[model samples]
Structures are given as C-alpha cells and as structure tokens.
Target: MAKTGEADADAFVEWFRAAAPYIHAFRGKTFVLAFGGDSLLRPDFVDLVYDINLLNALGVRLVLVHGVRPQVEERISEEAQYVRGRRVTDAATLEHVKDAVGSVRVDLESLLSVGLPNTPMAGAEIRVASGNYVTAQPAGVVDGVDLLFTGEVRKVAVAAIRDRLAAGEIVLLSPIGYSPTGEVFNLTLEEVATHAAMALEADKLVFILDHGDTVDAQGRRVSRLTASQAQRLLKELPEGDMKLYLPFAAQACKKGVGKAHLVSADVDGALLMELFTHAGVGTMVTRMSVENIRPAGIDDVGGILSVIEPLETEGVLVRRSRERLEQEIDNFFVDELDGRIVGCVALYSFAEVRAGEMACLAVDPTFRRGGRGDGLLAAVEEAAREQGLKHIFVLTTRTAHWFIERGFVLGGPDDLPAPRKAMYNWQRRSKVLVKDLEAA
Candidate 1:
C-alpha cells in the first residue's frame, strides 16, 4: 500500500540515508546537471548554491548546464528590438549569445566561489570552454521566420567531456555550440544535459527546474519514480506543461545514466533532503528493473546446490553440499519465472554495516540469454540495498567480464572483510568484483 503523511516522509528519509554511503562511492564520478533558467531565477537560489557546494565536497565531478531562454528574450526586448520568442542568431545576435552564455557562466562561478574563496577559479584557471562537440538538427521555422541559427542537438562527443571530467575539473556547459561549418547552434538546456550524460556515461542526470514538484492523485508529493513509472506519468499527463521534461529525463536513463532527479529548487537543501533521508525529495527515474532479490527458503537449497555443484566440480565454485546449503538457505535468492525458480545467487549480507557478498550465481540454461543472470545479480544488489549495505563483493573465476559489464569494478581479495578473507581457500581463488552503492 502507498504510505501516507509522516509515513511517506519517513520513506523518503530511509531511501536517502540508505543511499548516503552508496552516494559516497559516487565521488569522482561524472554528473550532468541541467538547470532551467526559471530554476536559476528562483528565490531559493541560496539553497541551490549550497547543494552545488555539497556535491563538490562529496568529491563528485560536476557539469553545470544552465538555460538562458528568458534571459535572452529579455535581453533582446530591453534593447527595443521586436520581442521574438526565438533567439535571433545573426552575426550580432550570435555575439550576444557568446556574451550571454559567458555572463551566466561567470555568475555561477562567482556564486560557488563564495563557498570556496581563494581557490583558483578566476581568469584562465577557471575560464569556460566551448567547441564543436555538438552537431545539430535544424529546428523548424516558427512564426514565419526561418528561426535562423537556433537548432537542436543531433549528436555529441561525450568522450571529450569525460576527458575534462576525469582530469578532476568541473565542466560548465552553456547550451551554446558552434557547428562544424562555422555556424552557431543554440540548444535547449535539457537537450544539452541529456546529450552530455549519454556521451559521458555520467552517473546521474539532474534537472533542476522552476516551480514546485509533481503531486500524486492524492495530492501528496509523488516522491519516487522508476524509469517505467515516470514514462507512465508522462503518458497520463500528455497535456501537462511539466511534461516537457519527461522525454529528456527518459532519454538520459536510456543512455545509461544511472538516474534522473526531478525536484523543486524551492525546497531548502532538497538535494541533501532527498539524499540524506529515507524517502527522497523528488522523483528519481532509473533504468533498474523490478526484480526482487532476497533470502532463499529451505525449499530452494536443493535447486541452488544442484546448480552450484557443476561449477564446484570444475573448481569455478567451491564445494557446497546440499545438506550444508540447506543450513544456509537464508543466504540465497532465486530468480523466478511463473513461480518456478530459474536462477539463484547467494548473499553474505553482513560483512560491513552496509556491505554484502554475491556468490554462487547460476541460471537455468534455457534462461541464460533471457536476462536471468542479470536479474539474479540485480536481485542480490537490491537485497543488499534494502538492508542498507553500502557495498557488495563477488568472487568469480569466469564471468568477470560479465560483472564488469554490469558495473562491477575489479578488486583484490583484501577488499573483502577480514573474516571473509581468512575463510577464503586456495580452491576458491577467483577475480574479485566490487560494486559500491552509495547515495548522492
């Protein structure tokens, strides 16, 4: 059942706190932030600045993309020119965009400097950089005008952004780019963030926009959403103005960015609130599937041991007799298909306060390519996550590549807990894979 009132708030807090350490693992990971001009214009600007600083402190690599739609239209109107909603990017207007984007970049930098003064953020040391990384698709003409140089993004060079990110620098993209053929193309803020996340394989794509967040049918905050849920919401609200961002958020996740957070810039410390509490601040859209991972009952032990015995015989897995497995049945989770178990994995969920071990994974041969392995692995991760475990370990003789493909990174035996390492036997020697799941 859906939670209510304090219960709902508590859920947000729990999810946040659970994610906190997992978020810590995100340090040094690249994140693409798309800030709408309306959001930047919010009265709660101080809250936004504080959140940015907090992310910096957490060791996250930041990419700030700010919108300038209203600012540009306002700039043109103030000069007594006809107020065309579109950006008039002729020679003179293009120069204005250069100036405008520059101004926004400088302003953001100055705001961040308030928290970290005397840090080399002025002049060339922290100057903005723009290049031909973005290719364009001409937007159709509006209001009888050709709409000139304003265009949408058709492609991007994500590697270039990753280079900047890996070098321990914050990249601030200004949604303004020069085409290969000497023409300039203006892009939407969300499009800029979406393309960058895809190109960079960022850990998350955050869209901080103006106005309050979405509400549920019951009027409570629609606090959490998976990728599919968000897509459903988008479909249900086709006529809703807020739906403009739905497509961008989905595209970001589809490109493998881990999450897309749609939150209110009005809420004070919303980032920390969403991240530090259990139920988060706004909707988090993710590509993660809805597979359930948990402890296996006694009945599952025989099947699991049967699967493990083959690998054990080949030395890919250590020997675990059916009797011994029955005693440890609580350590396993099975992947189910129409109520029949198709795959299973073991979780040692108590090596650290928020740590677990994934071991003895096996899938029915028929379900091999049906994503049962991935499902079992994800289920193990989810079980650990629900237990508030911050990290999980896997020791595999084969399938190291498979784990890596699923976001596992290489580690040494020493990365395991002391007891686990001490209990390790030469017969079980295998490459270790570790996944760090912290909150952001």
Candidate 2:
C-alpha cells in the first residue's frame, strides 16, 4: 500500500502533467481580466493576486481592467443617478469617481507589488503599467436624459499596450478615459475591457463576476455558449451586472476576441481552475459553434481511425480495416475541435425492424473528461431517430457500466433484430444492451 504522502505526491504529479498542455498553449497569449472594485475587498484577494503573478511568470501577457463602482458608491454622499445601468456622472459625482478610481488603482498596484519571502509572490518581479490608453466620447443623452461625464470607449492604444506587454509588464486600466480635447470621462469596466480585447485581439477576455457562472433555466451551470446562444441567454437573464456585462463579452467575441469567460471571484483558485483544467470552472462564450458534430466524410477516415486504433489494439473495440471504414464512412459522425477530430461514433440502421446499432464510440484520452463522448452519442442517437428507428443497442465487452449508466438495460442476442442477431459474435460473448428510443 502507498503511504499518504506518496499518494499525494502522485496526485500532484498527475495534475501537473494534465496542466502541461494548457501551459504550453497559453504562453505569450494575451488575456484581459476585468473585475469590479469589490473583488479587491475580498478576504481571498491575496490568492487572486498570487494566481495573476503565476500567469505573468508563465508568459501570459496580462491586461487588468478594474471597476470602481463600489468604491465610488462608498465615497458619494447621495444616491447615484442611473438610466439603464449607466451612471449619470454629475459634476459632484465626477470628483468622487476620480478619488475612488485613484485610491483603488493605488491599492491594486500595492497588492501586485508584494514580494514577501516564503510566499507565492516571492522572487516574482511583476512590473505594472498604466496610462491614457483608452480614448473616450461622451455617451450624451439617452432616454431624454443627459449622461454628462459618463462616456463610451472610442479607441484603444493597441500599439502602446502591445509594447508594454512586450516589455514584460502587466498593463492596468482604470474605468476612466481621456477625450481628444483633454476632457476626462468616467467609463464602464465592461466597455473598456471589451474594447481593449477587440483592439488587441486578445486570446481571452475574462470577467470576474461577483457571482458564479451563468446557468440555464434549471439553474445548472452551463459550461459553454456560442455568441448566438449567449445573445439568447441575455434575454432570459434578470437585470443585474451579469446582464449588463454579458453583452460586452458577446460583442467582443463577435469582433474577434478569441473567447470570453465568466468566473466567480468568491471561489478560491477559480481563475486557475478555469484556465488550466480540462473541464473549466466557469462558463465560456465563443464566436464559433460549440457543437461541431457533423456527418463524417471520406476525408475524416484518418481522424476516425486515430481515435479508435488504440481502443482496437487494447481489445476494447473490434478492429476495422481501412477499406471497410472507408465504405461505411457515411454512417459515421465526428466531433471536431479546431479542425482536429477528438471523438467519433457510428450508427447502423436496420430499417426492417426499426432498430439501430451504436458502435465504435471513442474519444481521445486527453479530451475525454469533456462531453465529447456524450456529444458523439447524441449525434448517433439523433441520426437513428431521423431514420425512424424505435430502438438502439450496443454490443460491448468492456463499457457495460457506461452504457448501463446511460439508460441501457441488459439484454440478449435474441432481443436484437433478425439481421443483427444472426451476426452476433457468440464466440466473443459481448454484453448486449438495448435502449428504447420512444422511452428515452
């Protein structure tokens, strides 16, 4: 038996190995982190700063955009005016905004400057940069009311920011901008972050929400959303900061920002878990469709073979000749990500008995924890249903538990359609599991 410390060491080794791919992929990539001022007031803020330091050390170019809503609210004496969530920013409130932004910016700089011995920041030399990088224009009047000093982002100094990032500095931006006439304007965090991401073509625009990730109608956290799906979700979300910020995130995706993530600052290490782990801890929004399932073509044969060859070699799946797979390629479906086939499954129809066979389910080992397998299964099931099949079954030698957990019931060769039953491998003695499509 292994000792507890040894077991822990093994687990740590496995986790680090799993994270290696992400570390390699994210090196030198730009990520924009946008957060409200309240995030700095949290008890776990030190941990967040440490994670930022780690990312900087790993060569991830960081642009931090901070909001001063709570800070400004604390400094103001009277109720703030707003129209559709945009602050009115009267002359008196403008003074408070300046003070609040200055104070919060100094505190954040102080936190990032920490290099205490025996701490995560020890030996980490993180340089901070800030300036009038965001150009602004007044939001003017909306709903027949003047928004005054509240402004919208007009331009971002992409070249200057790139230079700062190249110089090994984390660029920080307060929710404030300067107009061409040297007039100062109060801005929103979402707009500044989105504009910066779009201008710089950042790899990711991350929003550190006060709450957890986005959820569906049942309140279950959704792991991913396409830009269209996110736009639809915007309609269903209640009036809050998420609703206000989601549009900006979606807009950034449409404008060519790589991906947008909404994560919780309340959860310790949420940022790291979301970035390094396979199944991220937050909801990701992207411009591309998340469901890339499509009917396999002749060109997909190699990719399909790559996914199943190992399983076939291990005896978990039956071997298929290249010629045989080519002939039946039209009956297969593949899950593709970034032009790589990560998973594949096949469906064979027996129209005479209204039954179908689901077979050759496989996913790449590194991509298994995600729902690629489930997606491939769903694609096969949908194709079977389209062919008017009333039942689907699988013959498995090792994945019996997987099928059982997915609602398949124990069955025998006699339960199969006549044509399939005649071909059952009696010598192999594979377990036969069946599911009723109508009952599903």
Tell me the TM-score of each prediction against the true structure. Answer: 0.58, 0.73
- In model 2, state the lDDT of residue 145: 94
Q: Write the per-residue lDDT of candidate 2 for residues 1-440, one digit (tens) a residue.
A: 46988999999998998789899999999999999888888888889999999999999999999999889999988988889878899988988999998998899999899999978779898899999999999999999999999999999999999999999899999999999998889999888999999999999999988754456555667666767778888887865556667788889988999889888776789899889975577878877544588899999999999999999999999999999999999889988998999889999999999999999999999888555675677678778989999999999999997787566899999999998889889988999999897776
Error of 1 at 417 (Å): 39
Model 2 misplaced regions, further than 4 Å:
239-241, 290-440
Using TM-score as the measure, the top candidate is 2
The lDDT of model 2 is 0.88
Give residue 206's error in model 2 in angstroms: 0.8
Tens-place lDDT per residue, model 1, 140-196, is 576766656677787777777667766766677877766667677777787888888
Scanning candidate 1 in windows of ten residues, the lowest lDDT window is 119-128
TM-score of 2: 0.73
